[model samples]
Target: MSVNARRLAAATLATGVIAGLVGLACIHLLHWIQALAWDMHGGTLLEAASAVSPTRRILVLTLGGVIGALSWFLLFRRNKAITSVSAAVSGTPMPPLRATWHALTQVLIVGLGASVGREVAPREMAAAFSAAAADRLGLSAEDRRIIVACGAGAGLAAVYSIPLSGAVYTLEILLVSRSGRAVAPAFLTSGIAVLISTGFTRPAPFYTVPTLTPSLSLTVFGALVGPLLGAAGWAFKQAVARVGAARPRDWRLLLTLPAAFLVVGLIASRLPSVLGNGQASAQTQFDATWAAGAGLAFAALVLAAKTLTTFLTIRAGGWGGVLTPAVALGAGLGAVIGLPWAAAWPGSEVAAFAFIGAAAFLGASMNAPFTGLILVIEFTAQGPTILVPAVLAVGGATAATTWLTRHAR
Candidate 1:
């Protein structure tokens, strides 16, 4: 390798290591905060919610929103912000300290029971660190962008333990580049980050799925139902963007934040599954234990509540990712849709539909179908039996979303 290439490689490796450590730290911090705040063990936010009283849940969420709003005001409002990983990869400069603060605040917000995912913090911090390092190394703009993208990917991989999906996220979403240079560094960084994170934490898939039979009829059903999920995903993305755009900047902290939190608290009081990023709810849906009518009702309520709360969380200035909530929403929607199917086809499992819904909805929302598919596979530890139906669902969703997006434009 040439001298510059070698230097770049070393920088990328260092970035990955730093990102991994930061990701692990964020995870630990979130757990510690949850333990202290909710007096619950190390399960997810949804699990923690179950242990607390409804009144306590309301107080926690409201208090979290207040703190999150204050943090945003103090830390982010003054800074000329490049708050997005994609922006960082596109060469928008973000100060490392400011970015770190942004990340820390996100961790605190999620830990305090905000209806949002904690995935954004690690990636933003990683991007900031990589950007700063690249600048100090005096690398070219393109090189810096690639390094930042790699670091962002590494952070995601470290958190999720999905190395390939992380690398693909960098190329498909962040960098939007297919060049060999970008691909090689991203994969290396993601792999190294995953390795580092695994040393600290056991490799546990996020979701557990029962044995499922992938029949031809299921594939056909997946194809038929997938477009609804796609439309839902598209609508979700649009609604979030619209809410963000319509709300005034100053109103977010003072007016919108508390109100949104109050609404979320009210929703959580009834359906605790709507709290947090929806991991527990999705897992519940995957269990397929509820009776048909009850399952459908619960799933429908969760889908509605989660969709609204997630939108409110983003609109009210909560810092988090939409991916988990999207999966949760999809799973619930799928379960609801699958209830009748299960009745008609005696052996058809609602869990299978939930799985497909996760992929289809997430893929369509993100406009990255393969990433969604891979995430579900890694999350559930499912093999080829699930892939054919998943692909059919994902493909149908993607096409529908794409067409809708174009027509909407």
Candidate 2:
């Protein structure tokens, strides 16, 4: 290789390693906080939450709100706002120190049982770190952008052990590039990060899923329900965007943030499923057996609570992602709809329906159909046959969301 090419390759390797380490640190920090707050040494967030007293839940989250508000205020007041991962990839500078602090604060709040996804923290940190490293290496702007995007994907890959999905996230969502140059580095960085993370994290899939055999009923369900759920997902995405656009940034956060988190705590004291990212609730839905009437009502309630809390958090100036929250929303949709379908379709599995809904909803919400599809499959490590229904669902979802987005503009 030429000197420049060799230097670029070395830098890419370094970015991947840095991404992996950042992922680990964010995760470890989150878990540590969870343990400290809820005494959650083992078991899921829901279990830990359930064991805690309602007063404790309310107190901890309220305290988190106060701390988060103060920290965010200081961070933003002291520095120019850190650009998002997409903005960074598009040539906006991401000040590394500001970005790192932003990412770490995100992890901290989420660990305190804030109702937001933690995935963005690692991705943002990885991007910031990569941009800094690339600048120090004196790489070209194009190389820096690619490395930053790949580093983000690598961070996601390391955190979830979903390498292919991470690469797809980069190409499909961030860089919007699938050329040979982009493709190779995206996959290389993600794969390397996942391998490195395996040393500290489990190699098992992110969720616990039962054996799901594809059925004709599921195929039919996917074809029929996908578009409806797609529209729902689009609505959710729009809500988040609308609230985010209006989110507090000034002294108002001191009041709004604590009020929002207090509301979440009040609800979580009753539901417990609404706390933290949507993972625990999603897992609960996956493992649940949805019956008729009551099951549908409960699922609907949980979905509503989860959606409201997530929106509230964002609107209150809490920074996070909706990826996992969207999954939980979809799972709830599946359960609510699938209960009736089960009564009619005889052999339909609600869990399988929930899984399909999750994929479809994620695709629509993110407008990244392939990444959503791959993430679901990777998270469950399900059989290839399951993809048949998932693909149909994602296709329908993509079409519906695309139409809605175009019309809304």
lDDT of 2 by residue, 3-52 (tens): 66776798789988998888878878988999999999988888899998
lDDT of 1 at 240: 70
TM-score for each predicted model, relative to the true structure: 0.94, 0.96
Candidate 1 local lDDT, 1-409, one digit each (tens): 8867877887888888988888788878887888987886865666778888999888888888888877777764655344688888888777788888888887887787777777788899988998888887777778888999899988988887888888988888888889998999998898888888776454767887887778766777788999988998898788777876554345347666777887888888878877776686788788876754466777777777777788778877676878888888888888888777767775557888889998899888888888888878877887468787788888889989989999998
- lDDT computed for candidate 2: 0.86
Off-target runs (Cα >4 Å) in candidate 2 are 78-80, 200-202, 290-293
